[model samples]
Target: MATLQLSGVCKSFGTTPVLHDIDLDIGEGEFVVFVGPSGCGKSTLLRLICGLDTIDSGTLTIDGEIVNDVPPAKRGIAMVFQSYALYPHMSVASNMGYALRLAGTPKAEIERRVEAAANVLRLGPLLKRKPRQLSGGQRQRVAIGRAIVREPNVFLFDEPLSNLDAALRVDMRAEIAALKQRLGTTMIYVTHDQIEAMTLADRIVVMNAGRIEQVGSPLELYRRPANRVVARFIGSPRMNLLPGALVGDPAAAEIGVRPEHVRLAGVGHGLAGTVRMVEHLGSDLFAHVEIAGVEERVVARLDGGREVHVGEAVSISVDADTSHRFDAQGKRMAPAHNDRRTA
Candidate 1:
């Protein structure tokens, strides 16, 4: 395993700058994931670390050695791309051993390493099959196995599970998590999927428009987001943002509360609203309510089952202390004073 560090990393293609001055430190054996929307420089950041692209200005250190000018082949890193770049005619065993063969490794050594990686990835049963004969998930495993056979200092995965079906993606995600724990190598994964980042990373680096928005554990970003962009981006179904003026303090600006945090008021309750829509997800239900005075629609996640229907008048109340306050510029203010529920 190797520790990776980037200081003031900047990249640009002609006049358009894709990456700004970025600094990050990844410890040995740690799993760090970079997540962001497309054109956000996540992939470019990975390419910079792998030496596939040159940096305009910055320093990249791997295992305490400066490798800014090193060739990709000599960087001690292996990248698994989204598209499984496997050779169509080569069997799994041959593909896994191709890198070693090109490097002039002995036949016996190549077989030993290939067998080890195959065993780890559970590809031992499919060794004789070509890429055309494997399933999408299986082909991806082969791509990963090829990298494993190289015995790289760090593993770089760029949306390796994006091409799989939903079920296959879940299965492959578990496999990758298990593989990381077993190998314990430094890994950097890039993805646009927030769920993948939440489940797979020890810490997530949230990027936006060639810059980092926030870097924290999944729950931290969800619960105490630095701004409105992060609050909406981190959660499934997204957190509801209602347009409401602070009754007591004009300086408070806007209030933000999650759908799950909103409570249904019985009879004479809190804010009155007309139900716009209700979504039934079997175990949980979400109500989209339009408040009389507020312009934006508020969403409430009711526990158990649905209790209200469309066009019904209802009252909604949120634990004031549990809410988030955002300034006019969208920066998060002090958290509302409420008891936090444990996940």
Candidate 2:
């Protein structure tokens, strides 16, 4: 519905900088996710966009117009926070329609808009129930429904599913994904969960220590991280980093490999190690192998059916084509001519 852009955006609290030189372009109807560790300024950036916090410098634009001075209510954006923040005294319909009412909309129009949003969220049947009568997920739906009634140009979600249980988080994730498809509103979501960032975003903005690290599609960041920090932060079990000497690459400083790209091989064929730990996750097996010369443990993902045990001797083969090479400065190195096939 709208394009959001940030240029050299910076924010701070007192004298401590929270965001530094942040620049991003979010296209119309784009689901862009901001992901990083705690204290990484993800939420601060979201608040700046929502007008909850003012940017100390640079421009904030929505739909090609400067909105740095605009108030949150006038900025045409709706934020769904981690807390439901629904009024316990109000029924579902009243809570959802409250915003329209505050704007002096006619009672009939308020009812119409409320019912419309309820229908979309499947909250129609519970319109008359109080927030006290609802479950956690239902309350969250009410919160989302409240936002929907506003019909804003952009949606800002700040870890909206963090309060839910694991099962409900998954369910709510699917629901939010469906909501985005149905409305096609520009959305900027802030979360620390990489899985949510990977699955929900058209593009993920990876952040670290108040600075932008890399911005790309889920697979792009996973397959080719911009640097070592991103390489280690984006994956589960994390990528294994071996010294260039151990990887037989004298020109490189380190070689990185994802667990899934390494396979079990016969003894004396590849990097030999002792299986330090084995994790069976139904469909996949993750073996943390302790190599002789590598400082960090190397994890190899294999078939779950493979009977591997702790302390077992195993050889792990790295797919050179799939491996990532980094220079001494911790920057990703250009692949060798023959290794270009790894991508």
| Top of the candidates by lDDT | 2
Let me know the TM-score candidate 1 reaches against the reference structure. 0.93
Please report, in order, the local distance difference test score of every candidate based on alpha carbons. Answer: 0.87, 0.91
Which regions of candidate 2 fall more than 4 Å away from where they truly are?
338-343
Clash statistics: count for each candidate: 2, 1
The true-versus-predicted C-alpha distance at residue 86 of model 2, in Å, is 1.7
Q: Native-vs-model 1 lDDT? A: 0.87
Q: State the lDDT of candidate 2 residue by residue for 205-280, as single tens digits.
A: 9999999999999999999998888898899979999887776776789888999988776678777889999999
TM-score against truth, every candidate: 0.93, 0.96
What is the RMSD of candidate 2?
Answer: 2.1
Clashing pairs in 1: 321-336, 321-337
Tens-digit lDDT track of model 1 for 4-50? 99999999999999999999999999999998889999999999999
Model 1 worst lDDT run, 10 consecutive residues: 334-343
Candidate 2: residue 332 lDDT (0-100)? 96
